[model samples]
Target chain A: MSAVTAHGVIAPILVPLLTGTLLVLLRGSATPLRRTLSMLGVQLLLGVSLWLLLQVADGEILVYRLGNWAAPHGIVLVADRLAAGMVLLTSVLALFAMMHAIQGSDRRGRQFHVLFQFLLMGLNGAFLTGDLFNLFVFFEILLIASYGLLLHGGGAARSRAGLHYVVINLVGSSLFLFAVGTLYGVLGTLNMADLSQRVAALGPEDIGLVRAAALLLFLVFALKAALAPLHLWLPGAYSAAGPAAVALFAIMTKVGAYSILRVYSLIFGADAGPLAGLVDPWMLVLGLITLVVGTLGALASQRLALLVSHLVVVSAGSILTAFGLGGEAALSAGLYYTFQSTLVVAALFMLTENVARTRGAFGDELRAGPMLPAANLLGGLFLVLALAVAGLPPLSGFIGKVLILKASVGAPAAMPWIMAIVLITGLLTLIALARAGSTLFFKTETHARTASLPNVAKLVPVAALAGISLLFVVFASPIHGYAQAAAAQLVDPGGYLEAVLGAGATDNDADADTDTEPAKMAEVAGPRRTTVHSPPDQIMPAH
Target chain B: MEALIALVIGLLAGCGIYLLLRARTFPVVLGITLLSYAVNLFLFVMGRLSIGVPAIIEPGRSAYADPLPQALVLTAIVIGFGMTAFVVVLALRARADLGNDHVDGREP
Candidate 1:
């Protein structure tokens, strides 16, 4: 790869940070101009992320050192197939969500465009970062932006929901710091690839503390992923957010799942001596519980938005369960499902807003509403999305679930529970969505009729999401192939380590070749050693 | 000294958790702040406590405190401050909008 192409990993983080900063500076500009700028920025991000995905599509792990600093010393960004694909998924969702926002909702809050861009920056940063501290920073970035977005409209319900969301995340953040501190204390390195090596070579006396830190880290991620007991803050927060914001929020939960897959498989995978497979059983049980709880919540929801939020939880659960199964096939299936669920849930959130608007005073409540002027079009879109979300036949959701089920059959111990819960959840989702659809479409009151037709512009984004979801089913083979490649890269950490910490960093000869360089260079420089810390010969070129 | 630092962290964390479990938003915000402080202290201690030890590298010095954890703690404190400020504002807004200071906006 060329040097320019090697710089692609940082582009995902830089593009958004620069753009969001520009938007903040231009906050006083005309609305149309600001909107155009925001849209253009997101379009550029989509192209950049897609190019990155193609770069890593063949399972090449690309590591970009910030400030040309080497790993385990300076921070780095690693873009393998998994990270690249996630950035692409996020950019795609952001494009549609931005399209939906420009329709009207962007006017509801101060710096809506600014917050949106920063949120993207944070999400991309989280996916691409290779250091544990940088991961925490990115998490805070995304959570802060999400806090602003959630309270965009500023209502009683939103404020209430936002309070819980903010508090819970703050606590989660504290726990994350605690875990990170413990890890650094034990391993003395925050770079993930370096941590992987240290974890494998850990002394027996320190294993217990390292294991504790690892599990604590998992707990923090589970909170972000909204897994079961940690998921109580999701439904209320998601349902109460503005429609455009909620649509974008769909990918936020997957950040948790992505972190789990990355940290566990890399640092604590089979190579971590006694700490190997420590999180596997906990992940499986918590994921299953999250699935059941989410389904039950969906069934009991009286509002369309709340039901969709529960479905988000269900998607998180399914993804985690697949990942917890621990194999290339299972990880690949989970990745595919992550893509499908994010797209479908975003579309559903936008559709919910349109449906509520068409009903006027009746809103999104499960009770009967007035006859909608665009009933046929809205109902058709809802039916398709609901089927997709419920994981029914002839949709991408079904393909994802089937792939996961097929992967699960290999694990005899957990296969029955996985199959049973997944199938039952699908059934319950179908019933809940069916009932929701009927109430919104067929049970309209005759006394009142909504005269204004739903805006075709708003429906454009919804239709686009639904269309891509359908395309996901049609193009399942290529997508799943890409996912398998990503999973393959994830399972083997040697390449990742070499890419980040330089070649031979994982082998026994690493110390002789590289680690002693600073000492040797210092001795050679003699009295000038203080100024000779990182001579040109010592700096590793960006790969 | 290590024992004192550990006690401080434990006591702060315990009080923070207690406050966090309260039903009101004000107390919860305070709890989050206290918890973040405890976390910051814990992170600082992770570098191994030292008195008058230089964090920066210099010539002829064989011993120095690990600078990485101090950097980590600095970042955490800045982030925690921003979050605490944001949450405090959010609590005020919730009270103003919902007409209550309850975490749920209404009494249980």
Candidate 2:
């Protein structure tokens, strides 16, 4: 509640950011010192994330206006329990990945640390920002750092994949910019909370072209989210990137999901957008379809990292699909599963790195040796994660699915086809993981005297990811409860808007001023709130 | 008027898609650019274009064109530029390093 709390909220994005910048500035110093600084940055972000999570649990939403300006005019950063939870999760995994990247490398560790920090900064910033424009800015921050991290090994394979990765993301970012501009043209505002306020008052009567605009905007997001038909770029991009990079990027899709979460709940309000009743429902269906396609890709692929990372894509689709189902609990499960899958995929990526690095020279493709039936620790972690990915029983993943299924099934609001796909995809996912495990990890080493691979630190990140999944299972209820509250607040956006913008401040010209409207109309789109403005017949006048 | 604009967009989209389906990376990139332009113009026209008035208004000026779509289209144009550059660089890199300009992955 103090100024310190606001500082805390903003620090999650800034801590790693400053750390990354500092590390980059100090690159090529003493190796031990560089390693220490890299570890320090990760540890620092983890601490900040923990504090932010606790603040959210106290039932307080933190909104930090950059330079103390108001919403609409100035960029706003927010941390509800939901945003904080993601920050906490991302920070933990990032720390592990940073450690793995540093320890695994034979070169100086500082540059790696810098990229990792900036990447984390992007993730945190994307989650925390309340402005649509700022989201694009954060996407750039993440991608710029990602470009460096992706090409870390600097070889034929990484370089080729790196080109594709940069291109795909640049294209995605362009789509994002276009969508934002279009939406801004319609709404006359860019702040998400304020946009929600204005958007409620907009319809085809006032803006006949909204239908097309909305669809286009959603298409932009869909591409970023890798929704089914738009997901063709993901497997190649994730697969081509190296393991540590892939593991970090595994959670990158969550930025897209979080934007969906923000937009669906805020600007579009729960009931609006081009897709209408079909939006969330169709998203759910798309999620299931993506799940099937991604898992099948995993099963069919020969590479270890590619197979595991595709599961990350499937799980992302599943999260969106759950949202499509439309109950409070179902949506909450979707949120929780996003955090859970981030961990599971991270673990799987780490394990892939270990196996690949050990089999180096031959690591370009995911080939196997002649013998098998051992390496319990690494293999067991992989099995558990694979099971988690498939939504098997007693795990947190299954809990998310069960909650979604129970909430969605027989619900007339959602398309029946979507529910069916979720069920079918669940089955297919299991088959996919089983085939992958049987093919790659179960086989023995081809060469007995391949010589020891460099650095044991490579194991830490994936292990951290797997460890977090186990923690997710153990702490399912609390996490689920937080997601539920976050979803509830999402459903009733008034409180959130007020917390960020302020109460009763919607009448002012928000674009002209920074300090007034946001603090006053902090909360927006009260639950099932409808502005009963008289509907117009093509409110948009003809040319 | 709306139908005409839509038709133009549809035609551009069709041509873009046809080019996109080609085997070469450069053609696909070109197709993407053409499609982006068509889409941008379509979005611009979607604000229900008014020939007589610009969106920006001065004091005491009469009603203007809807301002929102214009802003959106402008941003989209800049972003499209960014995408085109990225694709161009990627295509060049693919050709230089891999010795092939096709989008297909090299088999191990």
Scored by CA lDDT, what does every candidate get? 0.89, 0.69
lDDT of 2 at A109: 23
TM-score of every prediction relative to native = 0.95, 0.81
Real contacts retained, model 2: 0.09
* Pairs that clash in candidate 1: none
Q: Model 1, range A206-246, lDDT digits (tens) per residue? A: 78888889989999999999998999999999999998899
Tens-place lDDT digits, model 2, residues A222-289: 77778888887777667656566667887788877877777777767653444344356557768777
Deviation of model 2 at B30, angstroms: 6.5
TM-score of 2: 0.81
Give the chain B TM-score for each candidate.
0.96, 0.88
The best candidate by TM-score is: 1
Give candidate 2 regions above 4 Å deviation: A106-110, A271-278, A360-374, A410-420, A441-456, A505-543, B1-90, B105-108
On lDDT, the leading prediction is 1
**Candidate that would win on DockQ:** 1
